[model samples]
Target: MPLALRDAFIDLEQYERLCAAAGEGERLEYLDGEVVRMMVGGSTAHHALTRRLDGLIADRLAPGGPCAVFRETMRLEAGTARFYPDVFVACGAGVAPDAETRGVPGATVILEVLSPSTERYDRGRKWLRYQSLPDLRHFALVAQDQCRIEAFHRQAAGWHYELLVGPDAVLRLEAVGVELRLGEVYAVLPALAAGADDRPAQAAFTPAQVASIAAMRGLPVSGEIEALLAELEPDACAAAVAALVAGDGVGGWAAILPERLHARLNARPDDASERG
Candidate 1:
């Protein structure tokens, strides 16, 4: 007879206490009741980009606004699960006092910093879960290895995407009343080759490329990848690639260049905006 495997699951209450027990300095999040350790040796590129975002948003909000910016470890719940994102912009004060608090039903924006290990989940399952929230205005995914950002805004009909790359690319956080240049976000990272969408190089993409493209769409990855690529003029693609490759946090510059290159070139830009 096969031995039964124990199911791993941590309820919300226990998840909260475990996090509290770990205390300051250590970062942790709950996933299926498991105390998953977060990447602590944050890439310098990641930190630099995040700092720029913080400064820009904080500055924008300085004019006395009700929104609050919360960074890493302020727990958020979706259904019965809980998660900690890199940063979150909460309107009118933010999440409740404790883990027990279900989070702001009207969350304005939630941001996640992409790491290779978490990329799939971050773009896939996590995004789908986030979309369930009624008041989620925008969802931003920042790539640490590449100078890229994909922002999704909830629209009256559905969600839409906004892609911003390169230092020159302007990132307008209209949902939060702020805008940042891609260059500013990647000001401190190193230069790298842009990533390419995983597709055939010439004669457009083959059937396989088409399938892969479809697969990428099914995942919760920023719809902006498509949006940005569609509108990419020669200058825009060059700028986007430059911005993505500039990040030092990614570290795998050589490895991801081809993919980044493809992504920047072939994808289409989205025009739906916040009105979609």
Candidate 2:
């Protein structure tokens, strides 16, 4: 017999009605019958990057061509999911505008700005669903807390993965003839700081300790790499280091640090540490 209760996940028809009743408010996304609210992100850095990329992408594209850029205001469907990508490029004919939402005509490229809470979902489930779209030629993940991008481009055989690091790294989508420079993309961000997505809202390590750790990682370390140490939670190879930092209030943790980092940063001759 059919179940007496309603379904856990809604169908596309139900999703449309929900969108209609949603009216004007926070953005909503549907995936595999689940509705998710687009909250817990929208950081200042996220907004700044989104705005800057919009300008850069728009500037590079020829004006008034079939190819065009769309912001978060636009929505696209992939199999059973609907996503409001931070920025996307669609070519060929345009989807007719609607009252509630503007559907994507054909998404050739999609880029999403990663946030702490939503990073997993964006990279995993959402990414899998997007593959169902036949026109999606390229997809990129923008790291808000650092200068990095993970891009995937569709190929005849399968998808090709490319990791772009450092400020000089360039993102090129051959399908649409689009290129994004990392330096220009990260200009909106400040000089340097470790990525805080894996950490609490506040920084976990002191500035001096971070610098010291950066030096030990390698002589004349890259500032980008230095800023990334704050996000790396070491494996449970060293419990003593975690205890010391936890008690000293140096790294702002009661426990949870790498023994290697302790041997390197804690043994510095300039042991005088200053908190950020």
> Against the hidden reference, what TM-scores do the models get?
0.62, 0.65
On residues 17-39, what C-alpha lDDT tens digit does candidate 2 reach at each position? Answer: 77777657556788777777775
Name the lDDT value of residue 122 in candidate 1: 67
lDDT tens per residue, model 1, 1-276: 111122476677876676668646566655555556566547776676666676667777646677777666465665655666777777765444354443543457888877766665665556666766666788888877666777776666455556666556776767778777766666656452232323322211222222233343332224543443454444444333332323311322222123544444333343322111
TM-score quality measure for candidate 1: 0.62
Q: Give Cα distance to truth, residue 72, candidate 2, Å.
A: 1.0
Candidate 1, 223: how far from true, in Å?
25
Give lDDT for model 2. Answer: 0.63
CA deviation > 4 Å runs, candidate 2: 1-7, 192-276
